[model samples]
Target chain A: MLIGACLFAAGLYMVLTKSNAIQVLIGIEFIINAGVINLVAFGKYDRYHNSGQIFALFAIVLAAAATAVALAIILNVYRRFKTIDPGKIDELKD
Target chain B: MEQGIFIFLGLTTVASAWFVAASQNLVRSVFMFFVTLFAVAGLYVFALADFVAVTQIVIYVGGVLVLMLFTFMLSSKETLEKLEESRHPVFTLKQFPALLVAAAFLIVLVNAIFKLKPDQLGWILQATNNTFRPQDNTVTNIGTNLMTTFLLPFEAISILLMMALIGAAHLARKERSFD
Candidate 1:
C-alpha cells in the first residue's frame, strides 16, 4: 500500500512538472499502476469473489488501449507542430 | 516468508517508480517504468491475484512497453533531439511545487487509511470479513463469474478495444500532400 502511495506521488509529480507529452503519458501510466496495485491488494481479502483481480484485468486491458490511442495522438501532434512538448503546442488556445 | 517477498517487491516498486519520475533521460525513465510495472505485477501475485499478475505482464510488459518503445524510437529525429536537449539531470524549481503537492497527498491518504478501520470502509466488506476463504483456483471461479454476472462489461470491453484499435490507426494514417 505504501509502495502504491509512493508511486502515485512520483507519477503525479512527473505529470505536473514534465513539459514533454510522452513523459506525461508515462506518468499517467504510473497512476494507473498505483490504482492497480491497490485494487489487487484489496482483492486479497476477498479471495472467493476475485473481484479485485477481475477489475485489475479490466483495468490493464483498458490501460493498454488508452496508451495506444494516446501515443497515436501524440504522434499526430508531433507531425503537425514538429514538437511533442505540451508547452509549445498550444495552437488550440486563443 | 511470504511477507518478506512482499516487502522486497514493494521496495522494488517504490525504487523503480522513483527512478521513472526522476531520471534524466526519457528513455531511461521509460525503462524504469518497465521495472516499476514488473514489480507491481509481482505485488499482484503476492496479493493472491496471480491471474491479474499474468495479465499485467502480458498487457503491460508485452503490449504497452513495446508500444512506448516503438513510439520513442520512431519519433522524428528533431523531436528526439529536442527531448535529449531538454532532459534535466536533477530537480529544479519547476518540480518543487509538484513534489510538495504529491507529498501532501501521500500524507493525507496514508493518514486516512490508518484512521479508518478497514471494516469501516463500506466497500471493503469483503476485505474485513477476515477469514480469507481463498479461491484456491481462481481461474474457474473468475470464468464463471464473468460469464454469469459481468457478461455485459466483458463484452463491452471487446468493443472498446476494437474501437481503440481503429481509432489509433485512423489517427496515425499518413497524410497526403496537396500539391
Candidate 2:
C-alpha cells in the first residue's frame, strides 16, 4: 500500500506537470497501476471470492482500452494542431 | 528470504518510478517505466497474485509499452526533438504546486494505510475460521470463477475489449475527403 501511494503520487505529479499529452498518458498509466496494486493487496485476504483479483483484471483491461483511445485522440490532435503540448492547444477555449 | 525479496522488489519499483518521473528524455523515461512495471509485477507475486503478475507482464510490458513505443515512432521526429528540448526541469516554480499536491496526497494515503488493521477485519477472521488454504496456483480458481460467478462481467469485458479495439482502429485510420 505504501508502494502504491508513492506510485500514485509520482503519477499525479507527472500528470499535473507534464505538458506533452503522451507523457500525461504515461502518468495516467502510473495512477492505474497504483490502484491495481492496492486492489491486489487487499484481495489477498479474500481467498474464497477473489473479488479483488477479478476487479484488478477488469481495471487493467479498461486501462488498456482507455490508453488506446487516448493515444488515437492525441494522434488526431497532433495532426490538426501540429503540436502535442496540452497548453498550446487552446483553440477550444478561445 | 521472502521478506527480503519483497523489499528488494519494492525498492526496485519505487526507484524506477522516481526515475521515470525525473528523466529528461521521453524515451529513457518510457524505458524506466518499463522497469517500474516489471517490479510491480514481482510485488504482485509477493501478494500471492501469480496470475495477475503474469498478466501484468503480458499486457503492460508486452502490449501497452509496445503500443507507446509504436506511437512515439510514428510521430514526427522533429516534433519529438522540440518536445525534448522544451521539457520542464524536475524542480521549477511552475511545478511547485504540482509537487506539493502529490506529496500531500502521498502523506495522507500512507497515514491511512498505516492505521489500517487487517487482524481487526471481520471478513478476514471468518475466512481464517473457514480455513483459508493458500492455493499453489490461482489460474484454475480464477478460470472457474470467471465462468461461474463472474460470467456476466467476463462477457461484458470481452465485448468492451472488442468495441474498444474497433473504435481505436477507426479513430486512427487516415482521414479521407468526400466531395
Candidate 3:
C-alpha cells in the first residue's frame, strides 16, 4: 500500500509538472496503474467476492477507451495548431 | 519466494515509471509507459486477480498504448525531435512545491496503511452475500452479469463507442472546399 501511494503521488506530480502532452498522458497512465495496484492488493484478501477484480477490469477498459479518445483529440490539436505544446495552444483562453 | 517476486515487480514498476517521467523522447516515454503497465499487470496477477491481470494487459498495453503510438505517428513528423525541446511551459516553473505536497501526501498515506490492523486487511478477503459462487466460471460469470444485470450500461457503452468512432472520423477528415 505504501508503494502504491508513492507511485500515485509521483505520477500525479509528473502529470501536474510535465509540459509535454505525451508526458501528461503517461502521467495519467501511471495514476490509473496505481489505482489498479490498489484494487489488486485489496482483492488479494477478499475470498468470496471478486468485486475489486471486476472493478479493476472496468477501469482498464475505461482507461483504454479514454486514452483512445484523448489521443484523437491530441491529434486534432496538433493538426490545427501545427504543434502539440499544450501551453502554446491557448486559442480558447477566456 | 513470494516476497522476492513482489520486490522484483515493484522495482520494475518503479523504474519504468521513472523512465516514463524522465524520458524526453515521446515515443520512448510511451514505450516506458508500456513497461510500467506490463509490470503492474504482473502485480495484479500476483494478487490472484487473474481476470483483471489479463484485462489490464489486453486493454491497456495492447489496445490503449498502441492507439497512443498510432496517434503519435500520425499527428507529427517531429514527434521524436519535439521531445528534445522543452516547449511545454508546465515544467519550466519551479516544481518544489509540487514535490513537497506529494511527499507530504506519501508520508500520511504510508502512516495510515501501517496503522491498519491485520484483521482489517483480512476483512477485504472475506466472502459476502453478493459474492459470486465458486461453481461459476469467471469469464462466463462476467459475461452473464454484463448481459443480464448490466445490460443497459453495456448497450450504452456500445453506443458511446459508435459515437466516438464517428467523432474521430469527422475530426480527422480533411475539410473540403465547395467553391
Candidate 4:
C-alpha cells in the first residue's frame, strides 16, 4: 500500500508537470497503473469475492480503449497544428 | 525468497515509472509505460490474481500501448528537434503553491497507509490464502463468468469498443474540400 500510494503520487506529479501531450497520456497511464496496483493489493486477500480482480480487468480494458481514443485526438491535434505540445495548440478557446 | 522477488518487482515498477516521467522522447516514454505496465502485471500475478494479470498484459500492453505507439508514429515525424522543443510556459512564483498542494496530498496518503491495523493485514492474508488454489487458476472460469453472469457488461464493452473505432476513424479521416 505504501508503494501503491507512492506510485500514485509520482504519476500525479508527472501528469501535472508535463507539458507534452504524450507525456500527459503517459501520466494517465501511470495513474491507471497505480489503480491497478491498489486493486491487486485488495485482491491479495479476498479470493472468493474476486471483485477486485473483476474491477481490475474492466479497468484495463477501459484504459486501453480510452488511450486509443486519446491517441486519435492527439493525431487530429497534430494534423491541425503540426505540434504535440498542449501549450501551443490553444485555438479551441471560446 | 519471496521478499527478494517483491523487491525486484518494486524496483522495476518504480524505475520504469520514472522513465515514463523523465524521458523527453514521446516514443520512449510510451515504451517505458509499457514496461511499467508489464511490471505491475507481474505484481498482480504475485498477488495471486492470475486472471487480472493476464487481462492487464493483454488489454494494456498488447492493445492500448500499441495504439499509443502507432499514434506517435503516424502523428509526427521522428525528429530530434521536435522532441527537444519545450512545450511548457515559464513558471512564475504562482506555480509553487501547486507543488505544495501536491506534496501535502502525498504526505496525507503516506500517513493514512501507515495507520492501517495489524489485524486488518492478518485478515487479508488469511482470506487470500483460502481463495486462490494453484489448479483452478485457469482462463475457463473467467470465460464462463463473462458469458453467464457478466454477459450484459460484456456486450456493453463490445459496443463501447465499436463506438471507439468509429469515433477514431472519424477523427482521423482526411478533411474534404468543397471547392
On TM-score, the candidate that comes out on top is 2
lDDT computed for candidate 1: 0.83
Off by over 4 Å in 3: A46-49, B85-93, B117-122, B125-137, B144-158, B176-179
DockQ of each: 0.70, 0.65, 0.51, 0.58
lDDT of 4 at B35: 77
Candidate 2, after superposition: displacement of residue B63 in Å? 0.6
Residue-wise C-alpha lDDT for candidate 4, range B85-179, written one tens digit per residue: 64343343544554566568779988987787533677665674656666665456666666777778778887998898888888877775412
* Candidate 2 residue pairs that clash: none
Off by over 4 Å in 1: B119-135, B177-179
RMSD of 1: 2.4
The sequence of per-residue lDDT tens digits that candidate 2 reaches over residues B61-99 is 999999899888889999889877876667889889999
Candidate 4 C-alpha lDDT tens digits along A6-93: 6777677677766678778878877887887888777655555566766677777777777878888888777777777787787883
| Candidate 3 residue-wise lDDT, B1-179, digit = tens | 98999899888888888767656667777888877888888887677666777888888878888788787778656755756665443334466677667678778888887898533654544544444443435666556666676677667776877777777776666665312
Residue range A5-91, candidate 3, lDDT tens digits? 767877877776666776787788778878878876775544434556656766676677667777777877776777776878889
lDDT of each: 0.83, 0.86, 0.71, 0.73
Better of 2 and 4 by TM-score: 2
Per-residue CA lDDT of candidate 1, range B1-179, in tens? Answer: 98899888889989888887887678888888888888888888777777888888888899998998898787867767777787665778888999899899889778876887655577666455642344578778789887887788889998999999999999988887511
Model 3, position A9, has a per-residue lDDT of: 78
